[model samples]
Target: MSGASPRGPSVADRGTWPSPGAEAAAHSRRLAGVIGSALDAAGGWLSFADYMQLALYAPGLGYYAAGADKFGEAGDFVTAPEISPLFAEVCAAQIDGVLRALGGGEVLELGPGTGRFAAGALAEFRARGTPITGYSLLEVSPDLRSRQQALLAASDEPPVDARRIPPRWLDSLPAPFRGVLFANEVIDALPCERFVMRGGAAWRLGVGRAAGAARDDMPRFEWRARPADGACTGDAGFVAAMAQRLDDLAAAGVTLPEGCCGEFHPQLAAWVASLADVLEAGLLLFVDYGLPRTQLLHPDRAMGSLRCHHRHHAHGDPFLWPGLQDITAWVDFTALAEAGVAAGLEVAGFTTQAGFLLGGGIEARLAARLAPPTAGEAALGEVARAQLAQGVRRLLLPGEMGEAVKVMALAKDCGAPTAFALQDLRRGL
Candidate 1:
């Protein structure tokens, strides 16, 4: 068996259905048509990457493409920026250094969820007297773009120029552009190719109709492995990367242990290359929950990190609620470093989010925010103090987002920033 081990029943069997009705079923049928058509084109099987692409970006029917809340308490999950202002404040410190080194440039952010991070970071930059040419957001979803615009407009930050780059203009990005680029929780959303190790060889995992399911409108998806001899998988890079990962596992005195499953992101190199191609100079910083290659592909994660988030509940079933929930996989920092270096960018530093925040003065910011007024000054409010403390703990505690999320930076021609200098984990990668 390929590592694409079967877990359990379909979404219907789980009893966690979302918004059931004729309308919802019709929506699924329409979206499934897109996926089914592609499956048909691929000879009744589509690579997991293609399946994921259709499920998340298929015109106006995919999850990200649909109108739905996807952040904070109301959304599937809460990001660091939403958890506290200190995250943006600390991130501002890092961005400030990069901007200062480049003598000021645009701040290009990818998938600016809720625009909360931008609002906070931009406000901090303004407080620090930093010069920002402009703020450009590259978002594909119209619904999300609207939310971001509304959030930014309501922010207390100064009136800074912020615009969304049109899809047509992505290929021909502004030339000679020099600025700091940032992405938060974006890598995990990138489509990954799933693979399983069967008997000593890796097999590509694909999506096809569940066995013996006759219904076309509500076709259940199942993990199916492509045949040997590299036929029908269509992604040579994915196969090669998965094979390399397996070899690495063997080198570490570990075997796939029959039925062990894992994932490989074949598009990471091109993704980094695209960013590096347009970014003429300056630094690129990305924050996400991931690990070094060794731990990411270790036997401990035999089932891989593929996950789905729906109404704050996480499950491994990506086939549930097709265009409603969020689907993501843990990032592999080693792949990121390799891609960045291959694109001619220098690896500045890599470290835990906790280290990055502390080194960037999150604690100082927290203290100043909660400091008592002296000499006939009023003290901070009890309720406000408690809330701030909660956010701090969530952001810095070892078991929380702190150690779970990682901070990595790639510089075009500058040195490592002090934020990451606090604890560089790049050597491990």
Candidate 2:
């Protein structure tokens, strides 16, 4: 938010769901005609991944790059962080454990969406009496950054040491800082190159057009890149590096707009390296929905976690609505752990949300919410009780966000002991 002010960033420029059934079919016809001819010149058929990237990230025509309502009741899926205040409250509790253990430090957040998570988390942190210098954010999108700014109007100053770092410069981790570097649903949003495993071959996905479609689209994808001799071992390190591009971008000063099409972060390793270097003694708490490399390339997931979110319907095709929907892939937590270790950070712990919450003394908190009041008033207490119950049901039930997501904490050598309580949960895993 410093330096030059954000450029004419006005989110009101777009607001509305897409209705492309009729128009899309018509547009598809025209695009297929032009695009098909181009593809026919090269060869035939486009891989699903290629087709997906162009549909989702292609400059002016990709899904997320388009102008669609991405979050809330109108968008695809709602993250737990987006649901209610409870998620932040729980996070506040968890962070308190970290700060208390570390004595004191800062809280830096990456890709804080619309400041909702920050608002909730900061509020809870304040309520818990945790001493945080301020909140720093590394945002890539001007629109989202502005939105986050407006949302946190009260704590107008930099949340901590506010800075606009691009996504590709992960090495710029603020050094000598003792605190928590927290990311909520951030890793999954990192760009990733997708590979499809077919007949034991791992081929990268890219876009090229086909000449025979009724409406020839632009350069669609054709899996022309030859695969490695054997099946791809799922290069965890390489994938991590790629995903870290956003972290690197934080410092690189890349100007990303609403409609620019580009590849997903392909530089995760560098990002991790930066964090490891600057984290003198602190925790890297990653809360996201990701899997280890094994599960990522499992036969069932051979196609990779590549999927497009259009009107909330996830599909492999990104062309459903250009500059409208979200293009995201599943993150590999196992890969993240590997990257952390490679960067000299010890993998302190990993567990499902249920495990983390339960391990972090959530049971006691939940019990307190339900404990029968001794001298409380009457109706007011009952209403508060109902709300508390609602939070528990939404956050703890396995069928909900509870068991669906996972939390991982990586730490430097000096900070491992403080994370021990929660680390115990992932011991047997």
Candidate 3:
């Protein structure tokens, strides 16, 4: 979900994209049936958040729930860790500093896609002699968990010793846990509610059956907008929340023009509270593409940040293939900070990914990789060096993941991580 094509497809370009195979189409149809039933029970209207939740997490049908290759070259998108081991290596440095500060602690990773980061970090930790009590991954997808186990098992660089901690999978957040919890490009995937401002009122954008489409037809879907007031069956208090959000923006000297649309993660507060409830003392780190409220809800971005990806083709249509494509919205860092603070965690640091990497000594890692091979080591070929350099550029350039991806750290009874020392953008939040 990290390295999506910047230029998404338009309505006209949808036809040019590859068509789903028979099996994929049938899978989508089955998921559509599930959604259609839910829609029927909901009186033909379901909030976008509700639809998104089902599309991405519904048991055995949603995107992540089913068995699908969702990472790397063969998947829908490539994440930072997939881009290069440098990302995980630098992240390990930050985690190492925190663990050392706390004497010792574990590392809990949320949505550890493909186990690439876990493998790279474990290797780095072993090399640096970093003391970690354990390494755990909280993956919701059964398919993904199996894949993680397979990859980690086949890894050449296993734990330093048999006694050393090996990665374990978690069913839920461990209560009273003391560790470092981090997620890369995970928050953006959380279901969010889409809203549009019209004539100073907010309307919740949702999904419903297309006009005149028969139930027997290929379950067509369409956008449906309703008042954000409590009148809707499942949208109670939506109006008040929207109003409050807009009022807060107005207080900051920004106002959304009429017809402006955007998304907000409805479960952000509760989600952070859940993390806070579990961690006795640790850091919560989230890295994703987003901006502070002021910029995110600014007038310039009137169209919003909702995006979908299928086979590397980014588009704006979430209705194209339910439970088949990846859907995401840009994170609201300001909201995330507010939630963390409300949940009794201190805002440790906030900065761009580029800043975090540089602060965590990515330069040193790059230098070592570029260094000549040892007498017995294999030579670093010119092509491999160029690829490595290209990957670094993609991770650090302002126009790429560097600026788009923001890193935020929240802590409870822990010190600020060293990764945000280079530049702190907390003021914007």
Candidate 4:
């Protein structure tokens, strides 16, 4: 709901990006054609959410659907899990607490990128002697799923004990479950509806074919906006919903000026509610780059939080190479808390990523790694200790993921986890 910058870069900036290989270029062209057909069917205009869905999830040609290195140095960007095993280790401690409170339960992870978190968390659980009933992963991308499988199966990684439960891959959420549900950087990727304020009303921003504009025989797309108040045949509900959202922001002391642009995940409420339905009793934990609604919707961010990542270069052009880039919008945590309450869950705690890490004992973990080395091990130990310190800094520094990212917990028939006790920012929400 936060507004985007007033003067952001134009789509023309995509020219400075490194070009994809011939095969990747062809893949993008094919995806573009698919999108063009969808636009044609939708009267040459598709809501940004719909376009994002296609670009990221379209069968075999989408960014996530196709074969591409998506995490770590070889990919677009690195996640906390990829940065260090300490992230998952700390998270594992939190999960261990929840499982102990519940007597024992399973762990379900959404979008387990590369299975690094799973591997690390499983190891931590084993080290602590936590009795986990099971470990399940709900991943949509076959490509990433295969990668996860390989990583978890590798002999070099921590082994899943025979007495303990083995990891399972799930196509959908299991019902009547009681355990922990974890998602990292997952909500941000959900398809979101972009809107712009005009004449004190909201207009839906969408994608449309750029007339006569073609690059390498692939059709070009441009931004197009339509009044949300019935300008489009099926936008009546959108108009009402956006109106209520803006009204809520106004009540929270945030206002958007005319021409302000932003995005909101229309399906967020339903998504959270679905998770609530499946999680009969347990914790729903989410860690991502986000903020409370008021801070997120501040007027200064007139252009919104939409971003595209390709080969480590972040930009605003979602139109660049379509399926070849990752597109995401910052999350509105205030909305998440509201959804949890409406779904009959308790807003247990919400805090910055730094607070969560520190509370989960990152300092102790680092100290253990940095313990004085023996005579023969001094050199290797020094190098490892330095790397550990750097990774911890990235996770806890205010300018890094520390302050920008937030961790939120929603509980059902459970007490607030100690992980959030260090610094609860729920009052801001």
Candidate 5:
């Protein structure tokens, strides 16, 4: 199922991918036309970040903005929560610690995918007698919101009161907010500023029509390199920020060779800063697939970590289906840590997902499952045990989510929790 393309190796293409239906295809075509118009208005070139924004968030035609099943076998990709409920249980332990440290507070989830994690966490908190004032979701996709609502409503009784924060209210988050903030697999989706190192200079990677491409036909957008002109692309601030990050990486003794291409997320710093600004006290925890700057920018990864996922088909062609595919870039943990520090937050801990979850109590959960049932309780069945084992393997195996997924916790006045401290990998970073 894997193959190499002009870009690089394809990793997500697996299983029987269901083709997009007529409606979805038409939607993609419409989105492509919109992007084409924008490209033409921009003098036939648009920065990759702009293109990504339009592709994933452009009003109603974009991938996320459109109503599409995006989180299961039938969807483009699967997230950890969808994989197993155990993920939320382990996360609950860490969240409980943060809430405990702050006495008691609400839970702010950046993107509650299908509300699975929220449900699991709420159940755990309720079972443990932990008090959660509220569960606030900042989800942008109305389609996803409906799905989340349906899933949560089907539950007999949700432990905490849940509410959605309208996008317009994001700028006015509870002032002096004190709570636990969660962002699982969120930062990776933030638009990345792709840059190309060619001709002994770094040029911004933009999207534009192929040279002499027929306007009458479907506009074929391709990678177009030009001088790093941020103002021309309406991303002046991002240009300066990207330059600073690259300079910082070079100062740390890591540099990419000429003709190499990669991505840097300037929005990450700003996003972290914005969150830190309103937080009077709390912990910001994140889980995503990524690597440290040194490793991420190593000579081995010349093409960077940008990738696309469509119907579980992991590929590198972001230009193929336009708004129909999910585009992402691997997060730079070192960059994240630096940003947290700059924002006056402590880089409490960083480690692999396996380590974090195990420290937070995955083994104990497995042990409880493996142990014999108490009197009048049914023992764990063979099929259930096998399923649990499979989930564990997928979560902890090196070739699976284990090594690739990273856990990082940033804190305000609250110190690092013991759960994360157990396997802190900040030294490696």
Candidate 6:
């Protein structure tokens, strides 16, 4: 329920597999032992948050921190950027509007995987005559950063002048930006805590086992009784459970050897603060796949959106492939909104990709430009026609990325907000 309300299966029944056996089982046991040993060295005891950090952020061995192919057909899954350049084309169109509003500015992007999104956006800007002054990318991995440079080197634009700056990681955002800052699917990378409601209170869920080969690896989803006052029980219950779990771990002197973790990025607020500072007179557009606080705080969303992707198999098993998986969680848009507000950025607009694109003339653009010519005109090849049909379906169909993904924008030091035609979905923020 925390996500877009995945209609495929009941979340309660998802990722509840008892255990794996044989070779896989043996590997799981070894991994658990290794995890415990590591945690013992770190501090003798570990919270679920600390466990997740090691599971996903352990130097050159953690999931994303490792040199694993996490995108495209060769990787665990394919993001829109890897699918084609078209995704960026549409995105660039939106960014153009923001930059123009800000009197023409630059761009700063985060975790631009393989650099395709940034490249495509830059190309679109050049082709559309947006006088972009500079482009900056903040990626952590040295390997991925180099890969991004190599990918962008093939740009068709004349004199591709861009800087691949090292973003202050997990700490602070750069200050005083005057351009359109954006990212695709970047918010999901933030950490989140997992808890289960039990005994009239929420109990923190940790990724560990009782010396039984780590039977449960996913967050044990739970719900607390709705409070009579309807206060935000989400944080209240979560904080309570976390405190109790820390107490228990301390009491037993047990260290989380090896396991996954769930956490929300308090750093998100910090990042937003940096964004507000640098955004002298421009807009910040963040596009990703997630819901708002209302949906996340829904009664049904007792379990959070923390999942792992490996070999195209989506689940909540961060321990399945230590150095060969992509771990992610749903972003708290409400948290993001608060971060923006805290930084003094006025919440200008928010909405889903479906509503935003449609309102911004997707259908109108298609009707005017994508029209089929008369018989007298030329014709596309069979393959071309097939590809076009598929492309149209992908961008317009409701069930696809057309609706599931979302777009949000915040502005500062601007004139009265000029209404852009896009579905605004920030109320939940």
Best model number under lDDT = 3
lDDT-superior candidate, 4 or 5: 4
Model 6 Cα lDDT, one tens digit per residue, 72-170? 655665566665456676677777776787777777788787888887777777677775666788776666777777777765653253332222222
lDDT of each: 0.76, 0.56, 0.85, 0.84, 0.77, 0.58
Per-prediction TM-score: 0.90, 0.69, 0.95, 0.94, 0.90, 0.73
Instruction: Please give the RMSD of candidate 5 to the true structure.
Output: 4.0
Q: Tens-digit lDDT track for model 4 on 34-123?
A: 999998998888999999999999989998888898787778777888777899999998998998999988889998989999999888
Please write out the lDDT profile of model 5 over residues 237-311, one tens digit for every residue.
656765665776688787778878888776888899988886789888999989887787666888878998876
Q: What is the lDDT of candidate 3?
A: 0.85
Worst 10 residues of 4 by lDDT: 1-10
Q: C-alpha displacement of 17 in model 1, angstroms?
A: 6.0
lDDT of 1: 0.76
Q: Please provide, for model 2 over 1-429, each residue's C-alpha lDDT reduced to its tens digit, 9 standing for 90 to 100.
A: 011111111121123434556655454444434444535553554433334444444543344343444566556556656554566667767777777787866777877766777877776666667767656776655556666777777554333322332112121345567888888777766556654433433344544542344233333334344343323333453344434433333344432332222233355666777877767787888887665544443444434455555544555554444444465666666667777889988888777776676666666776765776568634337766676666556566676656556788888754443323553544322
- State in Å the error of residue 111, model 1: 0.9
Could you arrange the candidates by lDDT from highest to lowest?
A: 3, 4, 5, 1, 6, 2
Name the runs in model 3 displaced over 4 angstroms: 1-15, 159-162, 214-216
Relative to the unseen true structure, what is the C-alpha lDDT of residue 356 in candidate 1, on a scale of 0 to 100?
93
Lowest lDDT block of 10, candidate 1: 1-10
Compose the digit string of candidate 3's lDDT tens values, residues 1-429: 233443222232455556888788889889998988998898899999989999999999999999888776677777889887899999988898888888888898999978999998899888888878889999998888999898889999984323577788999987677879989988999999998887777789999998886554468788898886666665765766677688889999998888889999988899999988988898999999999998998789888888887777777888887888889999999999999999999999999999999999888889998999889999889988887887888789887778889999999999888879899999888
Worst 10 residues of 5 by lDDT: 1-10
Tally clashes: model 4: 9
